[model samples]
Target: MLVGTIMRKIKSRTWKKQRYFKLQDDCMTIWYKSKKLFPSLICVPLFPVSVSDVEAIREGHQSEVLLSIADEFPADRCFTLVFRGRRGNLDLVAESAEEAQSWIRGIRKLMENLENMGQRERLDQWIGDWFRKADKNNDGRMNFREHHARLFSFFQMADRSQSGTLEDDEFVLFYKMLTQREDVLRVFQQFSLDGQTLSQSDLEDFLRDGQLEGDNVQQHAETLIQRYEPSDTAKLLNAMTFDGFLMYLGSSEGSIFNPRWREIFQDMSQPLCHYFISSSHNTYLMEDQLRGQSSVEGYIRALSRGCRCVEVDCWDGANGEPIVYHGHTFTSRILFKDVVTAVGNYAFKVSEYPVILSMENHCSVEQQRVMARHLNQILGNKLLKSTLDGKAAVGLPSPEDLKGKILLKAKKLGGLEESFSGTADDSQTGEVSSGKSPPSYNLKDYSRLCLCVRLLVSYLNNIVFESPHSQKLTFISPVFLFPQKSKQRLSKELSDCVVYCKSVHFSNFKHSHIHSKFYEVASFTESKARRHLRDTGGEFVHHNCRQLTRVYPSGFRTDSSNFNPQEMWNAGCQIVALNFQTAGEGMDLNDGMFRQNGGCGYVLKPGFMREAEKTFDPETPQKRDGYQPVALTIQVISGQQLPKVNIKEDSIVDPLVRVEIYGVPLDQNRQETRYIDNNGFNPVWYDTLRFTVHAPELAMVRFVVEDYDKTSKNDFVGQYALPLRCMQQGYRHIHLLSKDGTSIPPSSLFVHIRITELE
Candidate 1:
């Protein structure tokens, strides 16, 4: 099976510098370009060499003929073969060429040996022995087809258990047997077709060949097919139904995909229901716990469990627009219009409109009106008019025209009879006696219009209160009306109208004594009104006078504050509004106003409403004491009999440095508390002291000295503090004081404190 002839190097320029060797048994040559290094080498294999034989020669292959000629061989002697080939030719490549030649020779040698063994039965018997051990099915012979199937089966078995295909134990056993000797290696090589293992295609090729050639290979083919193809026993489980999906979702282990499961199911099945569940704290825990889903989506899933109401806070913007918000500050600055749009889209998608919108108006009247207009635009006349007929009659008017025109219409109708009576006499002759018919009027129609206007104004005022798209919002407001004349006028104008008024602060309604008056003004179904009062406390009432309204409690007060909830509740309070600054953080009105033991409904603060509109930093300091006159320094030394002090009396003082020291005392212990100086030669005059002192204990100290005008007794010329230590027994000299006495230390003079602390 010699595939090619090798060419040995002859005398050449390269050969002179290095020696070359050749081997003829395998017809290959080895070239050692330089062997001044090893000149004793007579011949080495060169071009057109087979790597397999070259490797064998390098492993010290010695034919009987060559061993007989050698006298001695060194242990460290090395040999190698060099081969050259075309660049792109795979077969000519040394490694590939060697592999191909090796495969052919090994196969041919095995066949010849098998033939010499005499009968095919002998080979079959040996194969049967190997197959009995290798085949898990106890097949009769170890053909390539059977071996391929077994390997594939191993992988399949591993796949089934989802474990490693070749375990350590199995790998050890296989390696030990496979590498036993050359005979085993030769047999395995032939079976593997010189490749390491049979791939899927190789297995298929072997099966096809066995089938086409009548090779009695049916057993091997059957085993390969069985192992490689999926059996009827292996089918996937069925997809789950809606009920089944819910059941799965409810189960602990089955809830593995619950987060995305519901949403994915909603996407597929299009469930008609969705919900939003608000948490007390604005933590993303619920959303995070739901496996990276959005907060709203998580809330929807939670609501799908069963929820009819969701609560959200509302903020009023600069233009008196009411926007939904959850906390003290607007977490999201989206306008009320945008919120309506979003909710509308959601409602359209899910086919369910929200029933209630609980809104907490933290906006100004103007802002509320702006947002209300936007909301009315989106919600149409539903919010303004409970019934379609009322809406049509009222007719939606522009915001600008609403207040003036609506009020004008009310006034005109109120004086309708009067106007007719007065003009009746002016009509000439018997013009049906214009006033004689008793001035027929539709009071019901007028009342309906007024009710519509009232409803529209309430809707406009509490834009954040009503969620037309979702039934989740419950309007919450403080009953307190602003002290501004316009605000008061507006409140007085709207007081008769039916609207939900939550008493935030007792003081809001305390002045007007409107708490009891509210109940008397409107009528409610006995049962419904009682229930409303009972549920929300007496502070809450359901009124159906000319319109529909709900009264709730609100105001600013602490949980432990000395306020009575029952009193306020009985007084018809509905809301308790707490000032954000006064109330502690993490404060939650968990059970509504009536629930707290001392909760006087809700604490209401008008100041907080104004404060909410702007951002505040509590860390900033404010000026406290008003501007005061300051006296500049007048220095005086102890030993020198009080150098005449010069003082600038009136100077604008620094805001931070409020106090100024104008004089000092000379006494150590018995210091002069008051300043005294001689006006005349014989008499001493007591003067009111205006200087601060930093002197220690002194005796008979006249540290404070002031110069006053003799005639007017109005102006003090100079003031000074003298150290009494200078006159003491041991003290000979004293430090002169700067004009501004350094009393209380300069470092402590300009300290800053919070306004609250100062108060």
Candidate 2:
């Protein structure tokens, strides 16, 4: 412990064998602690890891029970710590009731504080905490000089077969214990000479011949001596040494995350519009657009999934405050204040990126005032009240600069007026000029006409209306600019709120190659998006890069079914708004895409999508200049925890594996795995499936395990999908998860992945 820093000590504790100890979020230091002592037991970090709940526990005695790891341990006495990202529970026991209560309060406080932190701060803190707690000795450094015996013990504990070596799945599990990064794993695979297992001799040769990269060559050399080239040969490693383990951890080879790229400076430097934002449509509804309940949980759920943009439809409420719900429908109603509070509190919990509050307002002046007040009070400093430099920016601020801020994007009184300025102003100037216009309407009427009057309470808010793109609080409210003979006269009566956006009913792919700002925010339904994807995908890619486009569910989707977001993401549309309550392939793909880049909800678009001047035709395949075609091979070996679907018969499921390869060129994607029969519990097929693909970077492999049925459709069992880029080259275990993004305990698919470059 640091000298000045203070930590409360528990009064008493039971210890069978203590290894490591530390208090941190997402990870407990037990893994490293055991590595320092003996590597018999440790808790693994779950995927999309999170610390769910913390509560106090007590018994009849003064001591408090924090956890019950043993089966016979009393459940009534322990405080449970529920965590996700891995299978099973990770509970830590506290000594006294006071200690348990203190731990619970501290953990809750951190979780509550997550909302208040800026996006960059939260990510930075999380990364730093992972590294600090991983340094099990608490000596501010990690070294393996004295822990080689324990490292051997660690290797031995995982070598279940006593084959005297660790192969594929065992290797992955062991490497995961060291670091969760895939980049490091790729480099580690280069040392496997036999193309299967890493034996004691291979490890020994690696220790002697491996070249150490980066500063501190002497320390690395000393580490090698303590392990392989020990002065006393009798102390030579039985397996791998602690010094070798520490060398790997300290080397550039074992980076947990990108050491240079994990900071805010690297991610936050791009324009807000440049990022592909994770957004939600009808955020208040839990199930359907009509009958679902409108509550705070919807907002919480959306934000927790890394959604950076959320829609809120507001109207007049019973009390003085405004209310949120679907208009003219049976959907339940909730307070507008409640939604704002929810957004402000949970916005940064999943991602630290800026949140765009897209509000559709239909409220009286009194309720509008109430909304303004609640936004200002509840959100406080988190609300983006002004531009960063206290002056109007030429363009919108970078996402990095707007970190931890809530931007209200609503149709304002006087908004951005670009090429189609107000009639009076345009007529007086004879063109789109930077000059100001006089008040053409009554002031009282202006206040009543504008629902967001208090937020954008000035005539200057009409800059975007006069021009095209406006940097005023990242506001976006596209309107159809229809040409008319009396258009100039009609525009004058409307005053400064001369909306932008030229409506183009895209029946054909014409008028795409043109220079434009965010003047035309094209909106499309799911069917329309898919139509464009099939007919003219290249056109959509070019169109989405230059300007922002939104794709929502079609009107026929009365039940609010969501379309596959990956199809839209492939074309680079930023706002692929889906119904959050719906769970299926569409939502599953959405969850998978945004899980990267610290789950901040905003991912920097690929190089082709970000370059507005450059054109990348989706119709044209990506360049294969130095690349060769790849043949993917997977062996359906065995499965665990195959769920029983036939309850009436009370019989186990006859599970079969269907392996699919989704490639960049649509024609190359296909399913190849054959079905297995009659076995559900530990079924082994040993069947191999193969497919050929051109682009590995733009490909994904999905493993779906389902129960075979002759009379009806195959019942859904469990599924797993991941990018082909991160897949292991040899035998590996594919863990299964339900549609709700939770791990199904013991449900795993053991497979061998073989990738051969087609010459």
Best by TM-score: 2
lDDT of 2 by residue, 451-556 (tens): 4544453445564356556554433221112221111111222122212222222334456554344433555778878878778777787777666677888755
**Candidate 1 to truth, TM:** 0.21
Return the top candidate by lDDT: 2
When summed lDDT is taken over every stretch of 10 residues in candidate 2, the lowest stretch is 1-10
Error of 2 at 164 (Å): 35
Which runs of model 2 end up more than 4 angstroms from their true locations?
Answer: 1-268, 364-366, 391-396, 412-516, 519-521, 622-630, 645-649, 662-668, 694-696, 754-759
lDDT scores for all predictions? Answer: 0.26, 0.56
C-alpha RMSD values across all candidates: 43.2, 16.9
**Model 1 lDDT tens row, 423-451:** 42232111110111111123344345556
